[model samples]
Target: MKTQVCIIGGGPSGLMLSQLLHLKGIDTVVLEKRSREYVLSRIRAGVLEHGFAELMREAQCGERMDREGEIHEGFYIAHDGVLDRVDLHKYSGGSSVVVYGQTELTRDLYEARDKMNGVVIHNAEDVTPHDLTSDKPYVTYRKGDEVIRIDCDFVIGADGFHGVSRKSIPRDAITEYEKVYPFGWLGVLSRTKPVSPELIYAKHPRGFALCSLRSQVLSRYYIQVPLTDTVEDWSDDAFWAELKRRLPEEVSARLETGPSIEKSIAPLRSFVAEPMRYGNLFLAGDAAHIVPPTGARGLNSAASDIYYLYHAMVDHYINGSDEGLENYSAKALARVWKAQRFSWWMTTLLHTFPDRIPYDQKLQQTDLEYLFSSEKALGSLAENYVGLPF
Candidate 1:
């Protein structure tokens, strides 16, 4: 098999990238190690920036999102016994976020592709990219017991952080910056009434907690805890009780819940790798960088990736210009690093440390208090919350 570009992983990043390129007249194919059902069923983060919505429309993937997506003006930041509202729409040039899960986005894009005669393959035997600099790169894999090999011009590593694409690049060429936070977010989804109209980042003596929603009917929340803490230790009732204690009393009035359908603890961390492009394989999304969900950045960063890469590929194909491809790494890293800073800063201030400096504790509270008191500080936060000017 042969293609202009072979994308690994059928996740949001890869799928969206392929769709964008297809619209631009570039031919590409995506390979997924996971099944179609698995990809569609894995419920994850569900927020999209307003600018992201515009891009989605441009890529022809925003019909359902337009129909059902909830647009948020900004977020509520609660700390030190007070709540400070950040107005993102006013600050980020009429920008905010829409509530839509990554899984549903993928499913929607997949269906769109099928309607447009686009390719999204599941159970992709085995796909490999080796000896990247050659005219035809070696890609080998197995389907059941049948082995196959593919040759392609460029290989895209859209598979996630743990995939083989990263490993394919030799060591020492990679420079990484990372922080494994002392806590993880125990996320849960329920058929419950939402606690707030907007996303809330609330800090309590217990730890950091978030109140958000999937819809008017279902609510989502995250609680900070030790990386080693297991859900088994916190029964469903205990979880609700803790949330009630941490959230504002007014929240309790509307905090009704049905049986929990999704629950998992995701470790909080900030990670990035340099030189996203190595020879023939170009990495995107989680394959290139990871940001803690503190700032609601993981998926937005991935979407940013599709826009960047799609433009670069268009330049290469239509104008016979490789300038964009040559600068892909440096271009993506600028925004990638900023997100790292935001996530790291938010995590440090929100999560309590084992030996937290007394002064640090005081400073965090002081900053929180200052933001609520100063319109300027709150405005700055509002812009960043909607996402850094990406």
Candidate 2:
């Protein structure tokens, strides 16, 4: 098979890029190592920066999102047994975030691809890119003992952190930066109604907890845990009891508890790979960078990457310009580092650091106190939370 672009991932980033490029009459093919069912089964963060929501509309995949997703103008930060709201709309100059599940968003992308009869190969094994430094690059994958090769103008590495995309690049060619936190988040997806109409981020002596909802009927919640903890270590009852202890008494009194539909423990980490381009191969999304879920920058950061790459591809193909492609790495990384800083700051501010010195804990408390006390501080937080411009 031959195409203009070969995207080595069927997640939102790769799928979104393919959809956008195809709309421009750019032929492309997508390869996924997992089945569609497996891809959609992974639970992820739901908060969408307004900019990301707009990209969905541009891709013609926002109808369901706009209809079903909730627009959150503000969220609460609970500390010292009280809840204080951060006015995202007021502080971000009227920008607000969309609360839509990644699963639903991925489904919409899949349906859109189906309508256009886009090519998305699932369960592709041993996918590899070759001749990346050359003008013509091709990707190969094994399917049922047969090797399939796709010749393309460009190869996109959106497969993910553990994916072969980044690993395919030579070690000396790419510089990696990473920081693994000492704790992880134990998240639960329950069918019960959410405790709050808006999301609540709680920081208590016990730990940090977040009360979020996919919809009014479906709730998603998380509590900070030691990295050593596992799903089997906490039953539904134990999880609920521990979560309640972290929340304020008033909020906990009205909180609804139920069996978790899904549960998983994800370790906190921040990572970025420099110069997202390796010859003709460009990286996007988790393949290039990742943030702790504290600020909801994981998928939104990928959206910015897709946005930059989409415009770059269009300029390269339709306008006969290589400027955007040439500057893609620097441009994307500029915004990426900002997100990393924000996520790191938020995580540091709220999470309990087992190894933190007493002075650091006091400083953390003071930081939260200053945030609520100062309008400028709140504005900064709101601006980052709503997302900075692309």
- The C-alpha stretches of model 2 lying farther than 4 A from their native spots are none
lDDT of 2 by residue, 1-390 (tens): 999999999999999999999899999999999999999999999999999999999999999999999999999999999999999999989999999999999999999999999999999999999999999999999999999999999999999999999998999999999999999999999999999989999998889999999999999999999999999999999999999999989999999999999999999999999989999999999999999999999999999999999999999999999999999999999999999999999999999999889899899999999999999999999999999999
Over 1-390, each residue of candidate 1 has an lDDT whose tens digit, in order, gives: 667888998988888888888887788888899998998888788888765777888889899998987889888777655666778887666877899877778888898778778766778765677887666676776788987666777888999988878878878788887877788888888988788888888888888889988788788888887888998877778788887777776665567756788888898778898889888788899998999998777888877777778888999889899898898888889888877887777787677776788898899888777767887876666676676655
- TM-score versus the correct structure, for each prediction: 0.96, 0.99
Best by lDDT: 2
Native-to-model Cα distance after best TM-score fit, residue 69 in candidate 1, in Å:
0.5
- As a TM-score, model 2 comes out at 0.99
Q: Whole-model lDDT, candidate 1?
A: 0.81
